[model samples]
Target chain A: MSTAMGNPTAGASPGASPGASLAGDPYAPQQDTVAGPVFTVTGQDWDAVVAGAAEAEDERVVVNMGPQHPSTHGVLRLILELDGETVTEARCGIGYLHTGIEKNMEFRTWTQGTTFCTRMDYLAPFSYEAAYSQAVERLLDIEGDIPQRAQDMRVLLLELNRISSHLVAIATGGMEIGALTVMTIGFRERELVLDLFELITGLRMNHAFIRPGGVAQDMPPGALEQIREFIKLMKKRLPEYAAFCNANPIFKGRLVGVGHLDLAGCLALGTTGPALRSTGYPWDLRRTQPYWGYDTYDFDVVTWDSCDAYGRFRIRLEEMWQSLRIVEQCADRLGNSEGDPVIVADKKIAWPAQLAVGSDGMGNSLDHIRHIMGESMEALIHHFKLVTEGFRVPPGQAYAAVESPRGELACHAVSDGGTKPFRAHFRDPSFVNLQATSILSEGGMVADVIVAIASIDPVMGGVDR
Target chain B: MTDPDARTDDDKLRAGSRGEAAGTAKQEPKVGSTPQGAERDLGVQEEMPENTVVPAGADSLEVIAVREGMFGVQGSGDTSGYGGLRRPVVMPGASPRPYGGWFDEVADRLADGLGADAQAAVEKVVVHRGEMTIHLRREHLVTTAQHLRDDTGLRFEVCSSVSGVHYPEDTGRELHAAYHLLSMTHNRRIRLEVSVPDSDPHIPSVVAVYPTADWHEREAFDFFGIVFDGHPSLTRILMPDDWPGHPQRKDYPLGGIPVEYKGATIPPPDTRRTYG
Candidate 1:
């Protein structure tokens, strides 16, 4: 730090003379007033502080906060220009986690694209997978042929993913602002949701189950019961969080009126999901566009007029409840839809791998292996052709979007009559929402930048991808 | 920029417009009724949309020689049997109206707004499967995007994405930039595409019209080497500051490593011998 102004007595001790101003009046005795010094100056350090106060410039200082910062949620670097404690300008630097997913997708088969897309927003993998699969389906012109059962299952898993995602958002948002108890509470609830995800999808995260044809397989036995149990647990637990953080003055103070972005700002920045809804606009694609038969499900698009960090947090909390309500409806629908096919009848696009749980965990079913290896040559050829080259989507392009936990996570797919994608780019909400950070954080205290970023909830994996 | 007189592309386009600007001048009444230019299929058998290619003789269109491999890989990497599948590089031709659904409405309205200039500015209008794509000349991208966003009838307020698609097979025009636009007022989405040659990838930046296109344009530049000419601070968005070649472009090598499992080692997918 340039502490030249920190010491006033460097020129005032013994034979030392006071600088120019004191030179004008030798005996005038300088108090060196800078507003009012917060503390009394007596020691050498104190004298140095007062001495250096005269040398201090009102110029701005630039602070580079992490690409490795814990509060940034991922490898996001923020360059902030500060005038004292207040930030004058803020710019976000991303790409620390660019995995080159779009490039990789060009090399993989159409079905393998889901595995890559799911990893973009690791928090809400279902949304990415669904968007990519839907885009391919749109290219195939079989969007209407997807089974009703699969559609319900998609909504079910997506809502579950949203709940788990929002839990992490609130948990991390709370922890960043020093709510340790909430961090524990949030993760604990998230574990339950993840456990349910594991029960149904085989793996908790990066479930490539949602494919071009339909879901990988039907829901396992009694997975709905576990979801029902989670819903019950969350119903009792959500109000407790409300009682804890919502009532805590420190929490409310740090959130409300802090990192405020009104409706116009949200629109200008193209921030959606909770951030936009926080501004009181009900633009949830689930409700507005109603993909995946979301219209059949019963749930309200939650909104809060606060338009600040508190509002973003509040909307996440309520969105989880709405997710729970939707999950409940999906569970009820699962009863009538049990015998229905998950993957569509189009055998060409459908993954025929009879997945089974062996001692080594999930793998291709032994019976399916025997059947394919020993049965008709046509089955073997069909299986080999589908698995290796995958099905070709006629040359075209389509953009598919879904309301992810953060915002509108969209995938734009271009097909050139090839098994692999010609180009697949996901318009990750985290990347878009993060643009508002500079606007929301500037002119606010330096610490509020963390709150602003937390409210924006950018996953650098998604942002960089 | 909207003045039809100053930015005419060719004598043919200029001749087509005539005196359409009668201060609200009499535009070509049927406004580019038939596509006047030739677009060759480059001899690669176009499996889909075969009936759509205009019967004009394939000449003057430079054909790119297809190398052996899936994508552009040189070796055995044909894990998927799609190798040697010659997907003919076909630039979509103009669709005849009733262009179907709300697409016609958007297209007709855009033509009326741009008047005679629409024929020159918009190179082609393609409706594939369900979505509509208006292929604009790269130079007119910014003006067209602004009109799409501000026009009361079109009100495509949201510029959803600005992504680059690289097709090395499409000679001359190898890099195509597509903008996904959302009209919130109309609850519709339309794609705007601009094709530029890989030799000179100069598509005008739409950041002034849709601020959301700012970082997206930078990302397109980073991944596909498409230059958004007027973008503000058009620096790399997703790649490292000093990263060399845009990785997403066709012919960019798939840098892969061999996979080792148990005792056996399998060559990288690109190097694996394929049915092709």
Candidate 2:
């Protein structure tokens, strides 16, 4: 393995300057290093050869592990300085997936901004949609006036998103560490949550369901039934994670002490979600600073004292139970508020058309279509204006934050009193948490580097956005 | 499920009259700014005309530019006859004393923490829409941030976000960098803003006080071209290093190339029939 790690520098063309660019060809061997010692030991004398190689203390290897490597979890590049098996220094090269979403949002209207941000963190699209919508609502000064049913529905989506996002984190983490069974079960449970999302919002991922004033539409019939069934199924399936990996000797060996970060380190790095909760801080924004009426929901803030990969895993597992508790409460509230308005009462901001599922697909309800087409020329004009121009937000800035499955996801939305936003910036947790790469991976073995990053669990979409 | 039969003919006639009034009113764009003290009436009315509210208090607004067309259109492309729309671009001004809520307390604590240099360090405090912002001079940003974090009364342990905005019309202070700080201990949030001229757009990095600002400051620098003077390795983060212009600036073009299919060329989104 070390011989393969050592040959790239020798393969560089003669006289190429050290650290010169590969000229946009990613597959080309980096010619930055002088040739180093390489060894091959095939016999029982391997011990003697290893001892001799260990004596060459000045031999250091620079390894670039990603931007394409699978274990790095989505285009995360780790530049590592290794001495033997131990990492001496670690640095991160990111932004491989930058799509300029923030800049694109400036041209679209306030309501259209949700569609762009929902794509930022694809695994937790509802969190981005909710945060951005909350910011827009605050700028409009209608935070307190959001309908109770809408708030309850938002809580339901957010909690379900928490379960789904954490499942991906655990599944991918387990897969990276060679535990394929955990990966399969994690995804299996996640699909159930996605099923509920599909039923409620029509699309499984990047639904763009949550809007500035409220959700795109009211809950479809039978959504509550599926949610209740989901809660019941999760109650039984939740224990399997604890049973399978909680006490398994190998899982503990791989995770118990790897990627250890205490409360102080987490705060300094601005880490949140399970990574921070694992330090036993109980600093979840849902509890510490609630939004979307999360304060009204009854649940415990899950935490573990170990401050390591294993503790983060346990926090995610336990937090799913807590999320189920919130989801059930949201389902109950949704059931009671059956006929209430989901969008705001204001005609200027509320979407003009009422939506209903048709034989073809979702579209404006026939009743609404008839009222506009036949009865009211006024309503038709209003619909055309609102649909094409979108709603204008009063000029100002507001920062709205929600505790996402990842961390403190915030949207700092600024408006110039126009239909479009002047500026909209997201404080995505993946972007902030990835800064801890060096602090977490340095001084650890090469294998543990993967464990450390998997613990961070950054989705490159959110990180690069 | 509102009762469709509940709408009386009289009510429908009244609603129809109001809609026609609005349609005629929209054609002749509303002139003048929103009435002063309108901020006090937020969320009080169920229905409001678009662009009637200035989100901040009247005392804290200064009109920077007068927009001449509706939907932000310029030149001769607008044919909706709403091109007569005229509105002022109101930039938030310095707020007066007795700022409401915990904002006043935070401002006082931040000033006391800065001690002798508080007068020069903090340019002004603006409290708008239940959020507090302390405008700090670029030179004193780090010290002000240190005091904000370490001071007992204001232990803003987390630097939540750093964003940059470019106002080309703001002349000497064309570029603004805003930092959102969260005090987990006190359960309060505050923002610190610093502005520099576009000619010399530099603000001292606060990574020393809040290590988490590392990538955020880089992002601000990459998008808005605001230079963070002491950032460890201030390089483009979200955009490629070879990329030419800061894409988020107001002056930057939203670029897209035309596409041709079946011998017909289609213009890009920005060049299409833009509403804004």
Measured by DockQ, the strongest candidate is: 2
Error of 2 at B79 (Å): 5.9
Stretches of candidate 2 above 4 Å error?
A: A1-26, A29-57, B1-53, B72-85, B258-267, B273-276
Per-residue lDDT over A1-465 for candidate 2, one digit per residue giving the tens place of the 0 to 100 score:
112233334433321332233334454433223454333222253443344334444446666677878899998888887787899888888889999888888877788888899999889999999999999998888888889888999999999999999999989999998989889999999999999888888889988888998888899999999899988898988898889889999988999898888888888878988899999889899988888788899999998999888998999889899999999999999999998988898998998766887887856599999999999999999988887777878777889899988899999998877778888999999999989888887988989999999987899999988
Each model's DockQ?
Answer: 0.29, 0.44
Question: Given candidate 2, what's the lDDT at residue B1?
Answer: 8
> Which clashing pairs does model 2 show?
none
Question: For model 2, what is the error of residue A158's alpha carbon versus the real structure, in angstroms, after optimal superposition?
Answer: 0.4
Summarize candidate 1's per-residue lDDT along A51-112 as a digit string, tens digits: 44444444344556777677878898888776777988889888889888888888788899
Per-model fnat list: 0.38, 0.65
Every candidate's lDDT = 0.76, 0.79
- For model 2, report the TM-score of its A chain: 0.90
* Top TM-score prediction, candidate number: 2
Best-performing candidate as measured by lDDT: 2
